[model samples]
Target chain A: MDLSLSTRNVSGPGGDRTVVEVGGEIDVYTAPKLREQLVELVNDGSYHLVVDMEGVDFLDSTGLGVLVGGLKRVRAHEGSLRLVCNQERILKIFRITRLTKVFPIHTTVDEAVAATD
Target chain B: MATVELRFSAQPEHVRTARLVAAAVARRAGVDEAVLDEVRLAVGEACSRAVGLHRSHGITAPVKVVLTEEEKNFSIEVGDGVTGTGGGAGNGGDAASGGSDGASSGDLYEGDAEGEDEMGLAVISGLVDDVEVTTGDDGGVIRMSWPTTPAVTMP
Candidate 1:
C-alpha cells in the first residue's frame, strides 16, 4: 500500500534550525519514515526540531512512541523537540498519553520556532 | 444487524485499511462525528497490535477485523493468531502507567520495539472508552465498542 504520510525538511527562520513538515496518517507502516527523518537530523547535529503536524490527519501509539524516541535523541545533545500541531485529534493522543507534559506543543510553526527555553 | 469482516496478512500496511473500513462502518452506524477520530485511532492501535503479535509469534494466519453495527452500538474486534501473551485484564493494567513515559526503560523503543506492543494496547485503552482484551489458547482479540445514534424513522 502507498504511504499516505509525507515529510519535508525546511530551513527554519533561524539558521541551522529545521522543520519537518509531516502530512497524512502516521501509523505502524509510516512511522519508520518519520523516525528516520529524526534520526538523520540528530546524526547531522541539526536539532531544535519543529515537527509541524498541522497536516497530519492521523497518529497512533506507534507514531507517539517515535516522537518520544526522537525527543530522547535530541535531549541527549541538549537540543529541544517541539511540535506544531493545532489539530484537536492529533493533540488528543498526546493528552491521552499524557505526553502533553513531555513535549511542548504549539499552535503555529512560528510560535514553536520562536519559543525559548 | 450489519457486519463487515476484513482479513489480511499480518502487515503494518494493511492496518490503515482496517482503520479506514472500521471508521466508515462506524460512521454509517451513526457513531458521533466528534468521536470518529478516536474510533479510527483505537481501531488502528488494535490492528497494529494484532499485526505485531502475529509477526513476532510467526503466525501465518491473517489478522482479522470484524465490524458489527448493532441496534444500540457499533463494535470492532481485532484478532491475532497468538496465544498466551498477557490475557484478560492482565497487561491491561499498564494503560494507566503508560502515561508515565519517564520510565527508565530507555531502550524500549528500539529494534522492532517489543515494549511498543504493550504501549500500543495502552494507547488503545486510552482512546477507547469501552474496550476489552481477551486471549485464549488459540488466539487473542481486542474488542472495542462505541454508542451509535438511533436511526430516524419517518412516521
Candidate 2:
C-alpha cells in the first residue's frame, strides 16, 4: 500500500508552478496523502498546481472529491488547478464528471506545465 | 479459471489491505485493469458495509471474501455470519438501520464522513454488472460480478 508521489518545479505561462505527480491507486485509503500534499502546497502560496495522473492506476469518487476540493481551495486564492492524464480511463472519468472544463487537462507534463504560465 | 478465497479482520486497515491484494491478484490473472479495479472497489465497499453491520449488531469477526474467476467473467462474495437477520437485502443501509442487532442504521450513518464514504457502495453497485445478496443458515453473503470485458465505454 505504498503510493509514489513525485513533484516538479516549473516556470511556465503564469510564472512558477509546482507539478505534483501521483502514481499508483488513489482510493478512499490513500487519497488523504495527496490531499495533505496539495494543502501544504497551497498553504505555501503555491497558486498554480498541476497534478499529473497519467501513472495513476485508479481513482475513486473520494479521490475526485479531493481534486475538486483542492481546485476550489486554489481558486479561492486566485490560483489555478490543472491535470496531466493520458490514460483513456482516467481521462474518461474527468469527461464523465464534466470536470474537463473545470480543470485544464494536458497530454503531457510539459504541456500542463506550459499552460500554467 | 481459478478461485481465490481470502479472510481477514473487519477493521478498516485490514479492509484496505485485503482490497489491494485482491486487485493485484486479479491484474496478474490477465484481467483488464479497469475491471480489476471495479472488482476491488466493489469488494472493498461491500466489506465496509459488512463492518458497519457488525458494529451495529455487537458482533466482531473477520469477513470472508471468496473470488471466482471464469473465462468470461469474475465474481466475488463477501459474507459475515448473521443469518436469518436483516441482511442479504439489496439495500444494506436498511439492514443496518433495522436495529435487530445492538446498533441501528442511524448509528451507522450517523454524523460522520464515514456515511459519505458509504456512498462508495452505490458507486460499486453501478460499476459491477451484477450483484446479489444471500442470507442463509451460516451468514449473509454479498456477491458482485463483472464481465471480463473492459469497462471503459468511450462516450
Residues B53-154, candidate 1: write the lDDT tens digits: 888888999998999999899999888898877754335446436555663333454335566776677677777778888888768988889999998898
Clashing pairs in 2: A12-A117, A13-A117, A14-A116, A14-A117, B56-B103, B96-B105, B97-B105
Interface RMSD of each: 2.3, 11.5
Q: Write the per-residue lDDT of candidate 2 for residues B1-155, one digit (tens) a residue.
A: 33888887666556677687778767755577657656676777677666656666666777888878777777778887667554433443332233223222223433244543444444554556587777888888887766665455589
* Candidate 2 residue lDDT tens string, A48-72: 9989997898776457657766777
| Best candidate (score: lDDT) | 1
Q: For this target, which candidate reaches the highest TM-score against the unseen true structure?
A: 1
**TM-score quality measure for candidate 2:** 0.65
Model 1 chain A poorest ten-residue lDDT run? A1-10
